[model samples]
Target chain A: MIDEIVAAPGAGRALLDDYLARYAPGARARGMVLEQVLVAPPVWLDDQSNTLTIRWSLANAGAWWGMRAVSGADSAVAAWWAEVDARAISRRRSFATAPEAIVRLCDV
Target chain B: MFRLTQLVTLADRAARDDLAAALRAVGRRARSLLVEPTLEGSFNGGDLLVHASFNAAGDRAAFELEAQALLGRPATASIDSVSYSSEADGREPGLRDGIYRVLLLSIEPGTDRDTVARFEAELLAMPRHIAAIRNWRLSRVEQAAGARAWTHVWEQEFADAGGLLDAYMLHPYHWAHIDRWFDPECPERIVDARLCHSFCRVDRSAISSGG
Candidate 1:
């Protein structure tokens, strides 16, 4: 899964930091592994904000379901995201898999 | 007559069974009550499904106070409810023990009338696909008086709960064909993904009476 957050001007780093500090732990507990984090443009000058990208993944379909069930039961997970919505300009989470894995993934 | 259908998520996972048991005793508060845990098919199904009938609108306004303590704050993480004057097919609600299944959903905002009508027609035709639906009722919400203004309420009585969890879920028409309208990623999607698909034990018919 890929999470792309367009942060407000000068807010990208803080947004990324807050996500790591406040949301990552709960996500990790729910069996999602943090794959990578990136900031667009890499460097930020005055009045410039970066687009923060977070990549998270689960080992398998069962792990995916387990993570969802755990996260779904936690109201904190949703509350935290609602707060994130205010900090960022816009955010989207997209899920994808390799073409080779498509057939296997649909087995569920 | 007023019909209220609510799906409640518990702040505490342990609170599910207790809430179900508590709701069962409150049947006297409404003309009828069907409360139970959702078996599957939705993330928002919540811990309890509270389907009740009221003699008057004010009756529910009064009982919702008691419901606050039984289903509100502290114990609840979230709740979605709707109140409406129901529409029912005039079928006799034969007396027997059965499973009461309620599916509440909202069609995405801004869909065209033709598409919405087609979607509703397809959904109302489910009994033609699955024989297990012993009795059924499909109603458009007359009052959009819910946390979410659900567009439709599709309810059915099955001979057993397993019939719902198994047959209705696994049927070819349901999973392969009709599910496209409810699937968020599908191009044919109509209903929002946050649907309330829940069922509970019932000794009598919830369909014939609520309207």
Candidate 2:
């Protein structure tokens, strides 16, 4: 079961690419460089509450260059994020708390 | 002294549990070499969390090498070099066991150096206000060159999980003084996780009842 999940394709890179494609240029225009982006697999919390969590870590060239992707006038990245949020919410409601399903989404 | 905490996601429940057991056995045999060694499944079901403190950097490195060998793979690990420790004050460190909340943060680009220093100072002084904090340490990552690197680490050990959820997380001072740096509009990125474990070496009797 775990092997199947780990072998599945990940949406992280595609999603990150979309985000960068939409927002990276604006960030560069503002003199900030998006050094790196990392997305981890979905984690199932054993707190008995059936919480599923994901982690995304971003690194910028400097301290001032952060937050341009989700903030400011550009709404493209924000809109994309909202769609991801919606998907997560829907998943939470329908997810059977199955370990396999959790593992599948967490494949990063 | 330095501490290495590694968080890794395994493919299955069995593999995760197996690694935890192996770490526990290693801890049992190397009691003198490692302090408060811990291996447990993270509250998140599929991940394994390992934490061990060493009196010397060489010991810490050797342990990491051993752990990597045990796992048969390169694990995602964060090794924090302690830059400031309140335990160095000669007082019995109150934070030996309980729930540990760790925050790894990268500072925003172009932010004033002075502002970052002031923010750090406020964080170091948090125990002065919040009575629930048992042990608090803030350290800078010596190697911040990799994709997994974070600029600074803030670790606080509380009496229980409630101390984190009820007191520290909800504290007004934390929001007013510290939270802004992590705002989405700000220049910092943060990854935070909590671990529930006990320190084997801390003398609970020496810890003060008062904050």
When only the first chain is scored, the TM-scores of the models are 0.92, 0.35
Q: Candidate 2: where are CA atoms >4 Å away?
A: A1-108, B27-46, B73-97, B109-112, B144-147, B186-211
In model 2, the number of clashes is 11
- Cα lDDT tens digits for candidate 2, B64-168: 667767765444332332221123211235445465555555665565778778878888877776767777667665543223345675666667666665566
Model 1: lDDT to the true structure? 0.74
* TM-score between model 1 and native: 0.60
Q: Which ten residues in a row have the lowest lDDT in candidate 1 chain B?
A: B180-189
Please give the TM-score that candidate 2 achieves against the real structure.
0.50
Candidate 1 docking: what grade? Answer: incorrect
In model 1, state the lDDT of residue A82.
73
TM-score against native, each model: 0.60, 0.50
Candidate 1 local lDDT, A31-90, one digit each (tens): 889999988988863486689888888786556546655665566766776787787777
Q: In model 1, which runs have C-alpha deviations exceeding 4 angstroms?
A: A1-108, B13-29, B40-43, B90-92, B142-148
